[model samples]
Target: MPSSVPSFAELLNQCERSAIHLELRDCYASTERFEAWKRGERIDWEDRESWWHPYDQLIAETVARGVSVRRARIVSEPVSEYIRWEHYVTHANVTAGEEVRWLPRRQATSISLPGNDFWLFDGALLRVHHFSGDGVVVEDEITADPETVKLCSAAFEAVWERALPHHLYTI
Candidate 1:
């Protein structure tokens, strides 16, 4: 961990070849959009402007530049409300050119995973996300340590190899 951590956008901007994110949480704090969805506020799927956001734009641009961006989530099922919502909106990630996958916790019993969620950039830099018990992000720790990078990279690849693609994963 370093004293200074770059923002997610900065890390992504610096990413050249590939980036992978591994999420181990079953749920996260609800955002406004998530709360609205819980209230039965549905987004028109056909309307790109209605659902596409700045993050999506950034992802699109990054993908257009030929960088491969992938995300894998290790979730416990029968899923929580937040996980269900996340699955529902995952198309946004696909639309933005990210390949997303989901792995059931039961299936991951034998895999060695890190204590925190993380984004590994080009198999070199890492941005580890620390979160509270309730799944709220507390802080991000940045590191370039070889051992840390190796662990996270292996963990992500192990999950990705076993996880189901978003289109095939059903909540």
Candidate 2:
């Protein structure tokens, strides 16, 4: 029989040692976890306010890791409904990196559901797959496949090429 599938955390651990790619859609768990890991904090799903803190950490960690993080959203709507004026304020307060790429709806190629918005991290790849009316599911894994990595890399680049620069107002 084929070897059993690896667990999500196990895959992440493996990815840390090799090349891995991930894609997240319509949700923020991957980002949240990335942040939590960076800050050495625990992720508390029960606390709503606690979530964004980790997301902020994730962004900083991604920058520090020197790995490329790419995001794409439907131009017709904001990338995240969770992102509000306060979110921007929080981002400004915590992050000091240059403007990262933001892909608008017009630029993004629409894919079907069961398809995810992606969060590609170099060290540990994390993907959050969202289903309408349902919730988000996560897949963390490692792979040595260059093609898979290239596909995600190209998709991010395509979106980035068409994305507008993000401008945030500092508090």
Candidate 3:
């Protein structure tokens, strides 16, 4: 693993074929947006401009270049409030051309997953996210180790295969 980890934007820009993300945690650090959503705030689904984020634009652009951007979440069933809110906002990801899915944690009991969440870029470089128990990101470890990359790539594909597409998954 390299001490100097590149920003996600840099990795995405360098990606050629595919970028896959595996989110293992049921909850992440709460943000103002999440808090608002908890307070009953919702996106006017019809108003795309209102909720479109710069991150969504980056995903859109990456897809435009023919890269496959996919995200899979392994969440506990009877999901937490954060997952519910994440599910609602995922429309932004789909609208930006990224494929997204969800896998109940119970269904993934037999699979071999990394200890932390990760983004595998082009089946080569891996950015492993180390998060605090409170869900704040503590470090981003970048590695191009063949074994690590292979493990993450395989783990992502395994989860993706069994996961339900975002549209079909219910809270």
**Candidate 2 accuracy as TM-score:** 0.47
- C-alpha lDDT of all candidate models, in order: 0.93, 0.43, 0.95
List the candidate 3 regions with Cα displacement exceeding 4 Å. Answer: 1-3
Q: Report the C-alpha lDDT of model 2 over 1-171, residue by residue, as the tens digit.
A: 553446534443333323222233333433553454546664454464655554455444544555333344333345453332223433432353324444444446563322445444453343434445434343333443565555665665566556554553211
Pick out the ten consecutive residues of candidate 3 with the lowest summed lDDT.
1-10
User: What is the TM-score of each predicted model, taking all chains together?
Assistant: 0.97, 0.47, 0.97
Model 2 ranges off by over 4 Å: 1-52, 65-70, 77-99, 109-114, 123-132, 138-144, 168-171
Q: Count of backbone clashes for each model?
A: 0, 8, 0
Clashing pairs in 2: 23-118, 24-117, 24-118, 24-119, 25-117, 35-58, 74-105, 75-105
Better of 1 and 2 by lDDT: 1
**Candidate 1 wrong stretches, greater than 4 Å:** 1-3
**Tens-digit per-residue lDDT, 63-110, candidate 1:** 998899999999999999999999989989999999999999999999
